[model samples]
Target: MDRLTNPIRPYAWGSTTAIPALLGVEPTGEPQAEMWMGAHPGAPSRVDRGAGEVPLSEVIAADPEGELGAAAVAKFGPALPFLFKILAAGAPLSLQVHPDLARAKEGFEDEERRGVPIDAGHRNYKDPNHKPELICALTHFDGLCGFRPPLEAADLLEGLGVDSLKPYVDLLRAHPVDAALREVLTAVLTADRAEMARTVADAAAAAERLGGPYAPYAGLVHHFPGDPGVIAAMLLNHVRLQPGEAMFLGAGVPHAYLDGLGVEIMANSDNVLRCGLTPKHVDVPELLEVVVFEPGEPAILRPEDEGEEVYETPIDEFRLSRYVLAPGAAPHSLPDTAPQILLCTAGRPRAGELTLAPGESVFVPAGETAVLSGAGTVFRATVVV
Candidate 1:
């Protein structure tokens, strides 16, 4: 097991204090958004296995089969299939959706064939891999996920009683579930910028005045006033996750994290299609193609005991499980069939010989004999095999 030194992504939407508090460090005052803990090449974690401190990607690349095990390399290619993260949201992330595998490949290859630069702002697919994710809240987390039933959504908007929003409310009531959501979202995204800005402002004011169920929307406008996503966001279901609760965001699910801290794990891909609420490029046409238009409730996942308490998700790229250690509980053997990143989130737990404090993690190669002992909450990230 190698002690991992991860990179903290200082995105503007990050919380200044949440990640610092977890790591027992002083806030640098800059936003600390995500502490990435895997080999993604973009921000791969660092590890020192005697030779010198090097990026984990280089270490894995040198001996993919040895580090990741033969099965993982064969199954998910030479790269680590999962990217684990500690995501801290001080503000709302973009209203975004990710492409499914087929769409991802088509988009990536299409861009490459057209000679579009990979780093170009307009470029959508960062890689030809589907990014399905699970976020398990470490605090009282707030987010918007999927879509509500059309009439239900219309009721929420109608209650706000903003005149400019009446058209959307009428549209929502006029069409079938999927079409209502599709038309409202299309109108929100494709509307005249100045006109949409006015609507967003009105909606924001109404949300603020209403201030009950409408509070989260008011907060969105507080951060990004006049942004059309403030309106598009209302099309989705609002989810507030208490500690230890989880939500799985599958491909094409339109979602945004509004606030609080969470432990997130996803397939190692960064293909995102944005709807709104960002200064970043909004490929409306692409996003319309990528979003799943069906209305459904967000699935809130809780851990189930299957030797370890697992937060079950459908993707094979990653599996997340939690362990809450008491003072006298017997040590548990870690699953050794896959490469693992063991993160200690609270107290001091021992992973093999390395004792870990909150925010500390270790990279345990596949086939390693590892045991968990001591009193702390540890979240384990590994492949499904």
Candidate 2:
């Protein structure tokens, strides 16, 4: 097992302290967002084997199926087709949707056929796989997932009594799901600039008046001023998950990670169809095509206890288990059947003489059983199918 030095994503929405604290580094004042720990080619985790740092991709390629194991190879082909992340979202992410498997493959191939560069910022699809994701909250995570019933949203907006929002309230009350959403979204996005400014001002005041956690949402309104996403967000289900809780996002789900710390695991793809809430790239037609119009509450995943510190999720690409180990505890004997990555999240943990501090991780190849004797909380990542 080589000591892994993972890549950290520098996003504006990232937390300045959470990941920095984990790595024993003082906050850089800037957001140090996601610390990724997997062999996905986009930003592969690096292995420090005493000599120097090498991408985990190089390590995996040496053995391919052997490193990840036969099961992962059979399920996802000759690759560790998953990416794991310690995500910290201080600000909201773009409201976006991912394509289903078939659509993803087709979209990827089409982009490739057009000679689009993979690293291009405007490129929509990066891989030919669906990005079904599971986020286990490390802190209180607030987000908007799926969609709230239109009538419920209408009631909320009507109660707000912002005349500019009356159009949306009327649309929701009058039209069906697709037409109501499309019409309202179009009007919001393409509204008169001055009118939108006035509308947002009124809406923000109303949002604050409604009170509670959503009062802070008014502040976000100032950032994305007059942006349709602020209005669109009202139509989505507002969800908050406490620590150890999880939420799943399947393809075509119109969702946005609002804020907080979480561990996100997804299929090894970066295909995103963005609608709004950011200035990066918004492919409205494509987004509209892929996003599901269904309205419902977000699906919260409850991990089944397997009686061995194993937390089984409904995903096949990765299985994550949490181990809270105190000092003087016996060494953890991990399963030898598959490749596993052990990440220490709290305190210092020892594997023989090598001590893994918080944020430090170790990648154990398949068919190798290692013992972890530590004074910390460690999360084990391995392929399930």
Candidate 3:
């Protein structure tokens, strides 16, 4: 087991103090968005081996079989299959969707053939893998996930009574789930700039009058006034998760984190097709192609308690589970068949010889069994065999 030092991403929408508070350190005053703990090549964690420190990516590359195991090397081509993160959102993230593996590979190859630079702002695919992520709330978390029923949307629009929104209300009430969502989203994205601005102003005012579900849209409009994403957000489900609850976002599902902090784990990829609420590239046609337009309730994931709380998903690339060690609890044995990253979110916990405080993490190589003791909470990230 090796203690890992990771980099913190300073995005504008990040909180100035959330991550600092977690690590029990003084604030740096800069926005700390995400603390990534993996070998993602973009910001690989550093591992110390007594003499010196080296990039985790370099260590893995030196001996893939020894570091990642033979099975993982054969399946994932000598690279880590998952990326683990501590995500803190003070404001809101971009409204985005990830493409499936087939689409990701096609997009990546096509961009490479066209000679588009990998760091170009307009480049969509950064890697040729699908990203399916799950976020377990470490604090109160709010987000917009998937789509709500069309009738509920129509009710909100009709209550708003905005002249421009009437057409949307009519469409929502007149069509089925898929068609209504497709047409309403298409209208919002392709609306004329001047007309949409006026509609947004009136809608914001109307949303204030009708508070319940419409209230979130009003808040979104305040953050991004005149942005079409405000209107696009009204079409999705607004979800608020308490600590320990989670939300799993699969490929083709549109989502944006609104507020609070969480422990997020995903397949090691960064192929995002954005819709709005960001200064980054927005490809409308590509986003439409990748979105799943079915409307339903947001799927809230609750872990199954079997010694450890297992957060299950239908993916082979990663598995996230949590363990809460009460005072005087027995030491827990970690899985020895796969490479794992163990993160402590609360209190001090000892994993083998490594003692981790809040926001600290360690990388456990395959074939080594690490027993975790002491009181605190720990989240483990590993691949499913």
Best by lDDT: 1
List ranges where model 1 is wrong by over 4 Å. Answer: none
For each predicted model, how many residue pairs clash, with residues at least 3 apart or on different chains? Answer: 0, 0, 0
RMSD of candidate 3 to true structure, Å: 1.2
Better of 1 and 3 by TM-score: 1
* lDDT at position 144, candidate 3: 95
lDDT of 3 by residue, 212-329 (tens): 8887777777777887887788888999999999999999999999999999999999889888877678888888889999987888988869558989899989999999999898
Model 2 segments beyond 4 Å from truth? 119-121, 177-179, 190-197, 304-312, 326-331, 351-353
List ranges where model 3 is wrong by over 4 Å: none
Tell me each candidate's TM-score. Answer: 0.98, 0.91, 0.97
356, model 2: CA deviation in Å? 2.5
Model 1: per-residue lDDT, tens digit, 99-197? 999999999999999999999998998889999999999999999999989998999998988888899999999988778888899998889989988
TM-score, cand. 2? 0.91
Q: Which has the higher TM-score value, candidate number 2 or candidate number 3? A: 3
